[model samples]
Target: MSQDEPKAKETKRLVVIGGRGDRAAGTVWLVGAGPGDPELLTVKALKVLQTADVVVHDGLVSDEILDLAPSRARRISVAKRKSRHSYAQDDINRMLVAFAHDGLTVVRLKGGDPFIFGRGGEELEACREAGVACKVVPGVTSALAAAAGAGAPLTHRGSAQAVTFVTGHASTGQVPDLDWDSLAKANQTVVIYMGVSTAAGISARLIDAGRAASTPALIVENASRADERRIVTTLSGLPEAAAEVAGPALLIVGEAMALAQAGTAELVSHVEARGRERGAKS
Candidate 1:
């Protein structure tokens, strides 16, 4: 063949294989960052973060938890603070899809259990629709952490036979349309996540549905962390008691709340004494 014909053949070969470069595709991990403590992270979650190429974490994730990812990983903060949403759910979902499509290993880290009130289901559905390879890593939810922090057992032999977790807000940002009558039957623990803003309404609904106004209640804020706080009150005082709480809080209402109040008294007293001592020293 002539030299021109040989060059033409070589050009065609390069065009066919040049696009087949050894570029590694990426994946996304919908990892739960646990309640607030880094040590609460699951081994599998730590392993995923250690090698993640990119991390998109939520507002509640602690700084120590974010430190778990590789130093070279690109970290994106998509946190939604109180009254301020940095990124909407649809936007976050699209961002994850785009990151995965760009061939990067992404970790969508969230605080507490993703399935609880973290809107993880939405993100997971987005990934599925986009055909992105993704997996969910479960973490300790705030309900359990708050209960443990308050030294309360969610289920007691005779005090509580079941435990239910519910959100305070519906999709429309109003009080959820829950079966309040059934929930008022007692002998079960009810934990309300993100219910601080609606504490008064929830309390009213429960009492109207036959739950006693004298029912014990506890508000645990920043559960499982050093700055955790717990307030014990009656169902009628839930709204007022919750008003003093700051940061993400969980409300537990039931006979089990009585146990939490009694069990956590010593810890609360000790904490107070330490605070007093520090104040004196200062």
Candidate 2:
């Protein structure tokens, strides 16, 4: 082939490659990493992680889960702790949009189900406003994990007819101004996320609103992890019990909690053994 002919063919190939890159650039996926267990990740979420060009993840997400992503993927830790945010919500939203615009397949990996208090709704809205194509993949929330790990059934036939998951903190970092009366009378299982710091206030409000002080309550700390801890107490004791919970924890309160007695003793013993093993390893 003549020199000019070869050059023309090469130029056409470059243009096609550039067009393909442009076509694949503007997509984002909001994926849930589940409650501290990499194995809990959904197949779709795992596939997305494999193809992601960039992953922006939360603080509660496990490192093992992040390792599922392709080695070449750019990982960004935008994890937020109590009053400590590595990246503000607005900034994270902007970053996702900006990354997609740059032709990166962005993944916003959050702990638990993204829509469950993960600020994923706000991020989804941001993506919509920016005209970015986004998809959400749900994961197992910590409430469910905590209940399962503690051998508590969130909904028992004759005990709990429903279950409610609530956040203890508001945007101002204060106990949310929830309807205590309704919550107390609901008769369903109530799971409070991020309530460790506000356990005392939560217990007082529930009692003031007519909830039985003797209602069964359980606090599961570092749930689904090797060193997980479960503390069984009553509604009245939640405040004191929570004070001793050192790591990330979830609180479950309701009559259904009594069902925990079925196998909770064994589960607690297992957790204690795991804790000892971890301590020995350390």
By summed lDDT, the worst window of 10 consecutive residues in model 2 runs over: 1-10
Global CA lDDT of candidate 1, please?
0.82
Worst lDDT run of 10 residues, candidate 1, spans 1-10
Q: Write the per-residue lDDT of candidate 2 for residues 1-282, one digit (tens) a residue.
A: 101112324433432343233555568899999988677788999998889877888877877888888887877777688888766677778778877877789889998999999888999999899888899999888888888877789999888898889998778877899988888974589999999999999999999999999999989887777777788899999999999988898888999887663224356677789999999999
For each candidate, what is the lDDT? 0.82, 0.81
Superposed Cα RMSD, model 1? 11.0
Regions more than 4 Å wrong, model 1: 1-24, 262-282
- Model 2: lDDT equals 0.81
The per-prediction tally of clashing pairs is 0, 2
How do the predictions measure up, each by TM-score?
Answer: 0.85, 0.85
Candidate 2 versus the native: TM-score?
0.85
